[model samples]
Target: MDDIKAMSFETAMKELEAVVGKLEKGDVPLEESIGLYERGAALRAHCDDKLRAAEEKVAKIALGPDGQPSGLTPVDGL
Candidate 1:
């Protein structure tokens, strides 16, 4: 299994999609399905965090007096 913490947002999202597909098919054994569900949940949370962080960074960009983007602030812990 890959380290969820180290996985890129795109990678996590793709894996989560795959997990949903398998669960939707309803052909997986109960135990395996549970594992997949857990992993999917983690992936979902990670993706959400990544997206939220990105949104924050975008929002933090310095705007000029004319309301145009001037520059970006360094996002902490991103």
Candidate 2:
């Protein structure tokens, strides 16, 4: 859990992908598979939390005037 708390979204996502691949391969022992599934779920939850935080920040943004500075585009395919 501590490790997950410290992981960036991208890192967690990569680990989650690996976990999914292992589970899909169907070669892991049942007990190990269960553990992997739990880890994957945790990673997923962490990623979701990070995304929600990002969404909240994005929502608070306001576009500047045409002559003013322009930044912060829509998060496409989020």
Candidate 3:
């Protein structure tokens, strides 16, 4: 199995999509299908985590006293 933790979000999502397509076809053997399903679940979780982290970063934007956009605030616990 590939090191899923090292995979970028885009790469993990693409792999997860391919896994879904294969599973949908119902052509793989039972054992292989099980493995693929497990990997897909992991990828899905990883993607979700990455998205949540990104959202947190986006949420930390700072504004000036005039209400204009300034910059991002320091994201704690990164």
Q: Candidate 1 lDDT, tens digit per residue, 29-65?
A: 9999999999999999999989987899887799889
lDDT of 3 by residue, 4-24 (tens): 888999999999999999999
Q: Which of the two, 1 or 3, has more lDDT?
A: 3
Candidate 2 TM-score to native? 0.82
TM-score of each: 0.83, 0.82, 0.83
**Which model scores highest in lDDT?**
3
Q: How does each model score on lDDT? A: 0.91, 0.90, 0.92
Estimate, for each residue in 2-76, the C-alpha lDDT of model 2 and write its tens digit.
899999999999999999999999999999999999999999999999999888767656678764546655555
- In candidate 1 the C-alpha lDDT for residue 9 amounts to 92
